[model samples]
Target: MLFADDPGFPGLPDDFIQRGPAGIEAAAAALEHGKPIADIQQFACLPPFRRAGKILCVGLNFAAHAKEAGMATPDYPTVFARFNSGLVGHGQPLIRPRSSDQFDYESELAFIIGRRARYVSEESALDHVAGYSILNDGSIRDVQLRTPQWTIGKNFDGTGGFGPDFITADELPPGCEGLRMQGRHNGDVVQDTSLSDMIFGVKKLVAILSAAMTLEPGDVVATGTPSGVGLSFKPPRFLKPGDIFEVEIEKIGVLRNPVVAEA
Candidate 1:
């Protein structure tokens, strides 16, 4: 589906589906004749894609992140799921649940699937990607570590920060390689690294994931964060109410949010 705000196209629906290659072509054509939307930063941005079938996430995909966590790099990606309910848009508040004060930030690149594919090979995996965006996989550390499974802590309402904009795959280098990414707390840089540093790049991740199940359109795959998460610090530095966090990717733009206490 596509959401556009071109003044010339006065009757354009706020939400609509654009299917397959033809739909993409039509959207591109419309964009060529449309005027740019203004003052977007003042609006509450939604996740770049809505109604995502699955929100697949990878953990420790960066070697530095693994090292900082005192773990060996796994031969396979460590995958998890974050439901849509956990996601909040750019400029929205990320609630720190009252149960824990260990809220942490993880800066990640999120890829949205454009087409359905199963058993796809790494070489052709890029064909299935619609675009890329930013994600802050916020976690409540104490709860996340209480059990081997990380879902509970990771799935708390309003923990995930997504969007700002979705940049088409064609606008970026294939598989988004070599791009720089960083996580900033308030105004200070906390996590920074090159996308190339990821142990499992986009293509490899898609191939591996598709091998197990069909990747459907609008599904989101978060490539994982770098080192410098709160847990890796000498004294853990968890997020607190009034704190602001930003996740920036070289070309995809920034996903920013403010921390707030869960009411």
Candidate 2:
């Protein structure tokens, strides 16, 4: 099944992803049958879970990134919220708001929850993940640092770049470890690291986050990016109009977006 309108898809309702592993199994079975979604490229690629209930993010989860930001690694996860208006799909433009010139790029791993989880333990946290995707945590640095809470700067319309494809959790290594994540700007590789460098792994994140809130199916979490953000550079190379940034994660795919100045 490819399109949202694939009603004939077996074993799931319209919001199939919310159905968890059963939904994935249905789709995988179709794929195995060589029933590839025809003319898929003719459609625009949106976030696989476009109607996600909550979009959560982590900051300072990568020790190197925390050090680069001149901040200490926190005892607890640095959690944040990203509203719907802030994110755009792959190939969409990432708007650099006129409010500030510190538009920057961050390439990171993101995952979708597949089960209801509240106060779940790390041992069972990964079982709740349905699939994983790539997220470009585009940033407006000046405004982001202006406040203790980064809500405003991070929530500008069309800044967060997400999607391309969502890979089933079974396809990737447990906790998405050993995968390499790369952030390329205008075809030049800027940020590079192993997913293993994450100070807080996926299981740890899911467990910690679920303790504070009930993580529902279809909720997405953009795991924090590593070091090499523009803010840490000597001259601070921020994104501008006409620039293109690409986030490529091993085994998943690349999520590429161009930079555009806000009208």
Give a tens-digit lDDT track for model 2, residues 168-261: 8899999899999999989988899999999889999999999899999889999999999988888998999999999999999889888999
Following a full C-alpha superposition, what root-mean-square deviation does model 1 have from the true structure? 2.7
The CA lDDT at 122 in model 1 is 92
Q: For candidate 2, what is the total of clashing residue pairs?
A: 0
In candidate 1, position 13 carries an lDDT of 15
Task: Judge candidate 2 against the unseen true structure and give its global Cα lDDT, from 0 to 1.
Answer: 0.85
Range of the 10 consecutive residues with the lowest summed lDDT in candidate 2: 5-14
Each prediction's TM-score against the native? 0.92, 0.92
CA lDDT scores, all candidates in order:
0.86, 0.85
True-structure RMSD, every candidate: 2.7, 2.5
Give model 2's TM-score versus the native structure. 0.92
